[model samples]
Target: MNAEQHESGSWYWEVGSEQCPHGPEPDYDTQPEAWDIWIDRHTGSPQDVRICLDAPAGEACLQCSEDDGEMVPWESCRIREHARPKQGVVPNPGAEHQPVTVLVGTLECLDRECDEYFGDDGDEIPDMESCSHIREEQACSCQRQDDGEYSNDPCPARSLSVTGGTA
Candidate 1:
């Protein structure tokens, strides 16, 4: 199954496979049965290559009709819808070109009993990483290894991802 199809139906290339699910070693009479052919706009022009596109859906697909250029798995080969963009027209901005989602993880102590979590006098400690008391006094086994050497794990803080405004 294509992982990108769910994100966006737009495709960079149409991929097909014919490998068998039940394989007692399926017979391969040919050397390499599968192929991956991506849209190379530089190879053909709009006039020479008939191109169609679903502009609203932002979907563009191509197939080899006149010539045998479409790549398909040997077993199930069929002519798929062929689409190309007009010359000087930009291709679909596929799922890969969509805006990025950035998740920033921040650390904070979840244990209410830990003094440094809030602070000794009830004023919240600004930085838990700087709160050395937690490493010595609290249940932060991640601070050091059993042999007493410094551990690779960061401070035993509960990581939280928060947006600027409440959802």
Candidate 2:
């Protein structure tokens, strides 16, 4: 039998050929036979076989399709989508009035208890004037200290200003 050695060092023999000179061996399996045929027909290496087998059906085989000139079976091998520049908003010419800006400034708090008292259920206080903890005319003393409680000192009221365009 004609003896052939695989990468694993296992020897196989062609049935009805000259017996292996060294010792008895099993008949060549279909996988080895196909591998030899593929190598011979495509003039490809063992590594090429691995690449073709590992690659998905419609994707490019790295070993055979690495060259730019080589043809890939898929329509496109690109994995990421192309990014385009964002478009800016265009102002409407038919609009009757221009945009206005409203500025609301709140009193800055130094004390942690005052800060929590200003917040509604852990969220920022929507309107500082609406909170019962705030003192309308008096300046902040910054002396409030207690857990889950508000002090008698009320934070100063915030000023509101509206600008831009005729109001």
lDDT of 1 by residue, 1-167 (tens): 22122121232221121221221222345422321112222123323532222112233332221134433231111222111121243323443222121111112221223455675578866665433322222212333333222323334252332237766
Pick out the ten consecutive residues of candidate 2 with the lowest summed lDDT: 1-10
TM-score of each: 0.13, 0.14
Off by over 4 Å in 1: 1-113, 130-167
Model 2 / residue 103 / CA error / Å: 33
Give the winner by lDDT. 2
> How many clashing pairs per prediction, in order?
3, 4
Candidate-wise lDDT, in order: 0.28, 0.29
Compared with the true structure, what per-residue lDDT tens digits does model 2 show for residues 108-155?
221213464455568766555332332323222231222212233433
Q: Global CA lDDT of candidate 2, please?
A: 0.29
